[model samples]
Structure formats: structure tokens, C-alpha cells
Target: MQQQEIKALLSDMSLEEKIGELFQLPSYFFNGDMVTGPAGELGITPDDLRVSGSCLSVVGAERIHEIQQKHIEKHPHHIPMLFMADIINGYRTIFPIPLAQGCTFDPGLAEKCASIAAREAAAAGLHVTFSPMADLVRDARWGRVMESTGEDTYLNGLMAAAMVRGYQGENNDFSKKGALAACLKHFAGYGAPDGGRDYNTVELSERTLAEDYLPAYKKAIDAGCALVMTSFNTLNRIPSTANRRLLREVLRGEMQFDGVVISDWCAVSELIPHGIAADEKEAAVLALNAGVDIDMASPVYLKNLKELAEQKRIDEKQIDESVLRILTLKNKLGLFENPYKDGSEADEKELLLCASHREAARDCAEKSFVLLKNEDSFLPLKKGKESVAFIGPFTDNQLLYGSWSFFGDEQDCVTVKAGVTQNYPDADVFFAQGCPTADPGTNVLGFQKTPPKEEFDLQEALDTAVELAKKADKVVLTLGEHRDYSGEGASRADITLPSCQLELFHKICEVNPNVCVVLFNGRPLDIREINQKAKAILEAWLPGTEGGNALAGILYGDASPSGRLSMSFPYCVGQVPVHYNHMSTGRPFAGDYRTTRYNSKYLDIPNEPLYPFGYGLTYTAFEYSDISLDSDILHKGDSICASVRVTNTGERPGTETVQMYLHDVSASVTRPVRELKGFCKVFLEPGESRVIAFPITEDMLRFYNITMDYVSEPGQFEVFIGSDSTTSRKAVFSLC
Candidate 1:
């Protein structure tokens, strides 16, 4: 539909009809999932579903087409309902969680995964996916950390842009079966909730918000994300859903994001609890005026917006504006011409979890596994010769899809035990359920599957694992958080492995000292004990459908481990937030007891993370030469280059992520010790060498200054190019 047509439609909508469009009723309004919406509980008739702008979590190609057909028949304007779902990491052919995908450090691979998700989801009749969550996370205690790409601002923005491109394509074309609209979520500072608690208040300086958090969101918006979702938390005492300064002034006015702004689930109505609104009516008015176009799963908008408009307490023009944005999105999605866009049962059956899609998942899973510790070359296990005992909670459990793959069929998931058996038919592979995943009563999120798939008695489970370990030459203990432990509503104060898992590990290691620890959780864990005890540790991180195959593939030398840690793994949970790129401290902590006095060091534990960001081990080893700068004095207008010769010194082929870091010698405000400037992945065979050059343009050094100027400062800068952040290979150059 054209602008004139949308304007005419907006003009034709009555107050009640317009109010209906703002309400995104949950699927339970009709699906019997739960009793929700005005139609279900507030005495509104079934016809209320007709004008509802969208439906949430309703799936299936036929079901969607049926709903749209019935809705258009009842709606006066014949505007089709938009179908939206949380197609976060995957729809059916699940891939590694977003964080693990970020570890790949290959945006192209991430893009391919997103493309597969978009294709599978669109075929199932999902018009919009609330995905490409562009939140920069530092705290591992936050369960939602699993959903984020990691700590770096530049890396997050790059991944966000790649996801947008993968989902929506370059031309914003949704005409194809795989293409669908994407949404940038948790609008502002959702990742930095106080104490890393979910939905907690956030208080960040504007400069911090602008420099770190807002870049990823802007990149997604610029890449043509069709919508933005308000965060559940308040920003500086103002709830993001009702903060005009953030939604209007910054997002729409400065950033020029002329897209639909929707409230996070029931966020608008929660303003009463936030103490800002007197009632639902005030909440409705505040959100609308603040530029929230849709109120998802909230009663305030439908119940009060029309009444407020009639009383002149709120201008009807706000409703018109909100309704206009909704209409524009629908038309742009080509729903105006064909409501059943890209939704076909045939396509859905053919695409979801197909061989090709699962292969992509496996390939992606292979690259996403980070070999955090490979002491004594413990990995690349012998397939047929070694007697392997894989005993743990996840040995046979198919709960590998994590939290967001709501539609994922667990039965299709490959278990680690199964993968081992399949890979080496003759190898003696012993298995046992070592322990319960988490401490009892930790699941506050009300996880659906009442009986966890696998559980074992404390002593019996351990004794059995140890007995099996004694019989085998090697022990592979798989353990981590339960399925209920990490996701949107899940938050943990202590990010540690469960006590039962620790007990189980001890029992197994008592008899069999040569053990491989395979972690299967979402976020970075306090693996200090496991790292010290285990001969090798693989951070599998909720590898999806082909998880078992991918895990075994790495263990059996089918693929080399290339995934680097996007987030830092702490020595303990006491260090709630830890990262590699921190601003320089006046008294930085120096190693050793004598040097640590009067410094920014901890009383007991070291300030250093257990494993630094960009840290990973591969089968092959890469040697980095001294960084060479093109010139010592770099003119302000001219670009300088920092080059390094990287050689694959160890035998075997592998992919290495060559990362470049820069630090300003001095500035008006202190800068980070070292910031990741640029990185590239290089695949090398043994004895192969590549001279990688990072062009140091003035723009790469730009940062928000004390005066809020986003520009570069002319000064001497240190350059370090190597495999990870802690690399000391360095050079110096001066910017004139």
C-alpha cells in the first residue's frame, strides 16, 4: 500500500478500531495456551482478536493463514494481523546460542545461521522475528547473557548488522520465502540491569550509554530492522516504554529510526508499579506519547487509549500515529496484498530441520566450540583405540537447545553418548547420569518439563560414574546449568556449577585422572576448579541439533576447535562483571604480592579473569612475530598500518582469529588499557605464514570524549596484533 492508501486507512479507523490495533494479544486469546487478553478475561468479545495488530507465539503455517483469514473477515478495514514470535537463535534446526555464535568471530557464519533461522521461521508463517538482540553484556551472572553476542561494542554491532542483513537482506525485500522482518530488542541498557538482575533499574552515564550500548542498536536499525522493542527496565528513573527522551529524542530524532516502537511484554501496564503512572490509563497515555506504537500483551492500551482519547485527556492524533506505523509495517511486509506471505506448509516441512539445515547447524556448532584448555594435547581423541566413558547429566539428555528454541523437538537432538557411538562403532563408550543439573528450588522460572529428563541419586550416581571411569581409559564428564537456569526471566546471583556436578566430577577423577570436561551451559562459568583438574575442557555452550555430532567431531579429529571466547571467564562468581577492555586505572594491579599493595587488586582472588576474551586453543599452534608499523609518525589525515607475520608453527590445519588492539598513550580522559580495533580470521596449514595488516584509520580511534565529542585525539598509540587480547606482541606509532 502507498502512503495515500495508509493515510486513508488511518483516517478511516475509529477510536476503538485504532485501540485494537495497538493491542498485541497473546496466543491464549484463542489458542487455549493460557487465558489472556481482553477477549479472554476482560469481557471483550472474540471479535477483539480481529483488530489486534499482532499475535504473539502463535505458530504453524496453516494455523497462521487460518487466523489471518478469520481476522480480516471480522476487522472493518481488512488489515491482516501481523504474526510475531521469538525466533531468537533458531526455529527448529537449532544452532549454538548467540554467545557461542559470537565466539566463532566469523560474521559470515553468523549471518548464514541467521539466514537459515529466517527461512525456517518465515516458512512457518512468522512475519516478524524479535531477534538480533544487540545488547552489549559484561556480567555473566545475567542469564540473558546467553542471548547476547558478548562484551565488545564493535563486535556486537558487527554481529547485529550481519543478523539484520541475513534476516531482511540488503534491499529490505521480504518477497522471498526465506526473508522476514527483524526487530532490535531491549531498546536501551537492558543488558546492564543493576547487579545483573533481570528487569532491574539501570543508571548509566549518557557517554557510557552512547559509546557502548547504543552502537549495536543503531547498526541494526541502519541495517533496516523493521521494529524496536522497549526494554523492561527504566533508564535513569524513566521507564524506557514511557521515556520520550530515549524513544523520541534519541532514537527517532537523532538516530532517525523511523520504525515502529513496541513495548516489551506488559511493560506499559507495569508503569503503575514503577510509581510513575497513577493507573493503566496514564500508562497507556505515557507509552503512546513516548512513541511506543504497540503494547504487547498489555491491557492498558486497549482498555484506556480509546476512553482517554474520547475524554480529550490524550490526543487522538497519538492513536493515529501509532496506528499509522502499524499499517505501514503490514503493507511493507506485503501483507496488504497477500496475508499468507512466505507461509507454506510445504516449505515449512521441507526447510525446518532438513538435512541441509542440520548440516549448517553442525558446521556452525563445530566452529563455535572453544577449546579453552588442551593441556598435553589431550584433544583429538583416538576414535577406535581409546576406551571413553562419557558420564554426566547431558550424556543422553536432549536438552541442548537452551531456552529460546520453543518449537525445537528435543527428540531430534543428538546426545553426546549417541555421537560417540556413531563416530566410533567399536570404541568402548560407557555412560551414566552423574548428577542433577542444579540445586533444588533454583528454578524460579517454572520450567515446564516437571521431571528433568535425567536424574541420579547423589552417592549412587557418582559411584556408578567412577566405576565406569575405572573401566575406561578416559573420562568425559558433561555437566552444566539446567535448561531452567538461563534465559529471559532467569537470573543467578552466583554463576557457579551445581554442587552435585562438583561431587560427580570428584568421584570420576578419583579413579580416572585423565578426564575431559565438556561444559554445556549458556554463559561463562567459574570453571577454575574444573580447568585445574581436567586434562582438557571444551566450552560447547549449548551446541544445538547436531551438538553431539559436532562435539564428537572435535574430539575425534574431524574438525579443529576455532571458537574464541567473546566474553571473559572469571576465576570466581564474586567477580560479577569482568572484561578485557577496561579503562586504565590509576593504580592498576600488578602481578605478585609485593607489587599488589595499594593497587586495584582483590584481597583474595586475582583481578585477572580465568580465561581472557578472544582466548581459545586449537589443535594447531600459531606464532606471532613482532608487530611492524609502516611509520613511527602517522599524519592525522593519512592512514597508518600495523602488520604482523603469523605462522602456523604446529602440525595440522586450523583457523586463527587475528585480532588487533590499540591504546592511546594519553588522552583528555583515560582510555581503556587496550581496545579491539579490528580482527580477521585466517585459515592456515602447517608451516604456512600470512602477513596480516590492519590499516589504522583515524575513524577507528574515535570515542566519546569528556565533552561528549565523538572524535579521535592526536597522540602516541600502542598497537598489539595477535591471537587474543592478552598478547604482548607490540609496536608504537604517533598520530600527528
Candidate 2:
């Protein structure tokens, strides 16, 4: 099945058959087949399902094989249905969340995690994964920040491309069954929703969208992602699903994304609600004309496309184009020849949470945990001497897998208590849950079950934790938001640790002053107070299936915490959209907050984030020398090399994410105070020194200006190179 074969098949498909290819219906198997699932209520008949080209959210290897085989028998053309699912971070062998993965700033490690996910998911016969979500999130309140890498444009682009490569492999060949066609999702500014709320309006200028928002997606395409998904939110005033200028002009024409453009779940139908289309028929017409290739979980295309084509409301050629794209992807996957595609109950069982995969998960989580604060080096605690109390809701609970770990079994997750016991069996280890992780309506992800009636005793739990703290030499207090607090429809106004956990921490600190706080969260939390109270703080954002094993390794000094922050942690929730690479303000706050009137400063707090982007700490420290440039100035079309020598200033071996930032001293349009251009991660032994060099080209300085033209105006530029974005080791150079 090649391009020629796809073209011939497109010609042979009937109108209804072609329409079926455009519609991707939902499928929730096993106990979730009805009552609350999307498939049972989506109003799709057997005939409709048979002709459908893809089914999403279906799980189990054997079930997928059954569906595809059954679908082929009913369809006249016998085109096998593609199995798609949101295997975001991992399949069964979960790794750290994408946010935590990004903190490593090691695309190589990100690639490894994605490769493991691809292998586990391929065992389940998935043809495509809606992953490597390239959305650049600046706000912590955006729940899907759990899925995003972080706030920066360049950093996100690097990780996005790496994931694409990992998913698609060297070529788009899953012949041996590991790689899948990666879908770069929520195309065009889905992360920048208004108010940092999920699915909210997105208003952005052409320059901002093209410069900051579009790069990551474009990078993914360049890495050969097989598909792109339309966003739920509107870009500018037009919804992305129906916006022809976006889907056609920017994506298809400008970016040359010839891959199948699929809509997010129900986004095609939601265009009617967005006031763009008057009815479902118009929605279908707009979506096709706008270049959306598939309607995901929306019956609008299946119901109205045929009628719209007959009525001459939409061109039939648009239908042919979309069907062609789908068939071509299927051809690339070799699905036309082998529809089952290595799916079997036996293979799934063999690959699910296998030993090597668990080890990979452990490695990923170990590198992804960031030491936010380590007062007097309280961490890397020796297991034999210090009797420790691991008291928290997360201590015995198997909720380590974050949201979107759809295929992972929570029971399979190794708990902190179990991991600790495995490591230090004889040590006196006291454990108590500070509070319930979530009680009743606390879940915001639309749980249809009756809300639990709770009589959770906050003070009783606190007193128990306090008593345990007094008995142990040190208390390992774990705290975080409920699992449902991030990912999908889970935006929060507070963006802090749950109140019960915070209150429990205060009470426990009254008994044990040498307490260490281990944070298990999705998005970055506002923990200004917790950092102040605790002797040590570890930010392990939803470390995946083997989270406990990885946490144990870090706590016991088996590995040093190496992850850096991809997104800035806000000083408070009031500073919603804080980041390190913000554009320079006309009136910069030069003095202290109280003294800085008429300047860009917060009344209650400083404008700076609690922790800047690219910030992280390990058991050891690295010292950076002032940057050395190859030349003071250079002409256009020339490149300059900036070099910095980093020394492992501390005794222990550690990994450091070396970041390089650039600033145009003067530009046609006002530029950011600093923009990340390049970075390198290096592991150093004690007294080790290595010189890392970054080659900067003219293209790195280009940006959209007032006329919407991307240009790099010749000017003096400042280059900063160090461990993080706030590095002051600087050198000056000029471009003419």
C-alpha cells in the first residue's frame, strides 16, 4: 500500500465509505462499554462503526484485534480501522509526566521514555498516539500543563522533536511493532487559553502565534509526525476546527503539514456552539473546507458530510484529499497488509510492566526529580542510622501514575512504603497518612458516580502524623494535589498543595523540625510557604509507575536529583503567567517592590517567580566561568561560538543542565530580556571541568516585527551561559 494504491482506493470508496473514514468514533471496552462511556451514547450504528476508519480510547490487544477483524468483514472495501488512543506519557510502563521529563532538559532521555511508551503501546496494537503535545504553557493554572513541557519556545521545540523521533522511529516503520505515527496535538495555541482555563478562548497576534506558539508544532512536523490534531479553543476569534486561515493557510500552506489533520474529541461539533456554524451540516462543511481530515468522537461528519457533498455545500475533492491522507498513513503503518499489526493477548502480557521497562521508568523518574531546597543537605539520607517516618496520603497509596496513564494499572504502581521497605527493611520506618488524597466532589474531571460522603478528620490525621514525627528521627512528609487536579479539564485557581496536606505539614513541623517534604504533583505548585517550613523539598511531579522505586533511590543517595524546572513556579497564584524569557517592559521595576511605583511590580510580592525557568539543584554544585566569544562582532551569514568552562565545584557526581540565553540590546521591535537559544546537559565527577560551546547563527536572532516580517536587525547582543536562565555569566558581541 503506497501513494499509488492509496489514490486508487480513494477513487473506489463510496461517499458514505469515505465519510466513515473521516469520522473517528469512541470505543471504551470492558466494564466501561456503556452507562458512562462516549461510545454507547454517540448514536453510531453498527453499519456506521463498520465503515469507520478509526476507533479511539479502546484498550486491550485482543479487543482491538477483534474490532478491526470484525470491521473488515462488514466494510465492502475491507479497509481496516485504525486504533488511536491518548497514550500520552506511557502505556503500562509509565514514566515521569512530560512536565517533569522536560525538567531534565535531556531530549535523549525524553526520547527513551517515549520509545518505551511506544513499545508498550504497540503491544496493545495502537496505530497512532495523540502525544508529544507541543503546546507552550506559560500559566500553571492550565491543567494540561501536566502534558506540556514548559513555558519556553525553544526548549519545548527540542523536546517535541525528540518525542516525534522516538514515536515514529528512524522511519515511520512499526513493522517489528514499537513505533507509531505520532499526532502533534491541539494545534495552534491550545495551551494559551484565556484565564489559564482549559478550552477557553485564545486571543493572540499573528507575530506571537508564529514566533512563540507555532515553533514547537513546526518542529514536530519537521521530525515527521504523521498527523496533527485541531485544538478545542479558538485561535484569534475563529475556532481552530473551523478557521480556514489557520488550518489551510498557516498549517497546510505555510507550514506544509500535509499529514492528516484530525480534530480533538468533539471539536468539530463544538464549532456550532462557538457561534461560527449555524448547524451540524455547516460545521461539517467548515471543518472540511478548513482542512480538518477527521472528526474525532463527533458524529457531525458522519451525519452531514454526504448530504453536504450532494447539496454542493462542500467540494467532494476535499473528501478525497482527507481520505487519501488517512489511507497514506495506514499504508505507511503497513496496516493495509497487516491490520492486526502485532496485536495479541500474549504479546501484551509479555511487554506490560516488564523488567527492562520498569528499570527505564525508574531511571527516568530518578533524573526527573528536582531538589527545590536542601537545607544542610538533609536529603540523600543514610538508611541504617536515622529512623524515618514516611507519613502522607501518598505513602501507601498507588496513585503515582498521573492523569493520561490510561493503560497503567494503579495496583501495579510501587508505593513509597513498599519501596522504602525493600531498600531499608530493618530500619525503623513509621508511616501514617496525613489526610485523604481526594474525598467526593473534589475530582473535577467529570466523575459521574455519586460523590463520596466524607467525615475525614483533619485534626485526627494531623495529630497521628505529629505523634509519628515525634517518634522518628526525621519525618518524610509527602504532599500534593489530587491526581485529578491536573490534566484535561482540571484547572485550579489556587495552584498550591491541598489545604489538608498544608495544615498537616504545619502541625507535623511543630514536633519534628528536621522534616523533609516530598512533593508528588502534576503542574508546578506555589509552595513558597512549604519551602520556608521544611528543611528539604523535592519536586517529583507525578513520577510514573515505578515512582516509588525512583523516589527511594533519590532519598537513599543512590542517585542525585538532576531535573531542572521547565516552567517557572509563580511567587503566588496572583502572578498567573510568569516566566523567565518575558519581553522587556518599558518601565522595568528597578527598585524594591514597595519603592517601585509606576513600574511593573506586584503590590503584594515581587514580580519575579519563586523559582525561575531552567532552575534546579543537585547534591553537588557546578561553577561556571564567564563566557568567551570567538569574536566581538560578525557580519550577516556568519556564526559566532560562545564557550564556557563548567567545573564540578562540589564533591559528588551530578548532572547539570547548562543553559544558554541571548538578548538583543537593541531591536526594531522590543525584544525579551533574555531568550533561550541553546542548552547542553553534562554529568561531571568531582573536580571535573568541561568547556561547552554554543554556536549562534543569525537565524537564532530572528523574530517577527511590526510588519509581521521575521528579521534579525543588526545590533549588539548579550550572551549569558550557565546552569539556568538567571545566569549572569555574560559576554557581548555584535551582528552587522
Cα lDDT of model 2 by residue, 211-268, tens digit: 9999999999888889999999997799999899998988888889888999998899
Clash pairs of candidate 2?
Answer: none
C-alpha lDDT of all candidate models, in order: 0.87, 0.87
Report the Cα lDDT for residue 258, model 2.
87
**lDDT minimum window of 10 residues, candidate 2:** 445-454
Where does candidate 1 stray beyond 4 Å?
A: 32-40, 440-442, 446-456, 593-595
Give the distance in Å from residue 303's predicted Cα in candidate 2 to where it truly belongs: 0.9
RMSD of candidate 1 to the true fold?
A: 1.7
lDDT of 1: 0.87
What shift in Å separates residue 401 of candidate 1 from its native position after superposition? 1.2
